[model samples]
Target: MYDEKRACPRVVFHAEARLAGADQFFDGSMEDLSRRGIFVATAQELAVNDVVRITVLNTPILDLEAKVVRCTDRGIGLQFDGALYN
Candidate 1:
């Protein structure tokens, strides 16, 4: 089994999310979130290390900037540039 090595723990969260890359933009669903990063379930393909703008479509409309760290057949993992939310 693989060891889970993370500074922060992810929380189970679902929300409407939008991601904008350099020239591509698409809508996805936010699966989970933590202080340092978030997991977005998007069919849209994004390369690792790609910088993207993330907008959480909620009543307050949370906006954040993140980089693609991991990618899978189901979704993508993103790491925030800085501490946007606490």
Candidate 2:
């Protein structure tokens, strides 16, 4: 059997992510992150196509803006606008 790998790279860290245009924010733990996108889990309900800004703890210098591509009961999948990570 061939094992399928993720199309995007993922980073493991605790971060704070907020939805743009929404007054709500969530404390999330990044499951996997890449320059292209990131996966995070939070208690809030995020709809698909929702634009958001993410700031990783201790790494606030890099402001990441992304759009929600998918959302599950536990987490959300985001796609970066451009080169979000260097």
Q: Which candidate has the highest lDDT of all? A: 1
Question: Which candidate has the highest TM-score of all?
Answer: 1
lDDT of each: 0.88, 0.74
In candidate 1, stretches whose alpha carbon ends up further than 4 angstroms from where it belongs are 1-5
TM-score of each: 0.87, 0.73
Q: Which digits, one per residue and each the tens of the lDDT, describe model 2 over residues 1-86?
A: 95647665556655665444367666677767676888888766788988888776666476678888989888888898986646
The candidate 1 region of ten consecutive residues with least summed lDDT is 2-11
Would you list the clashing residue pairs of candidate 1?
none
In candidate 1, what are the lDDT values of residues 1-86, reduced to their tens digit? 96658788777989998789999989999977888888999899999999999888874977799999999998999999986466
Q: Give lDDT for model 1.
A: 0.88
| Model 2 misplaced regions, further than 4 Å | 1-21
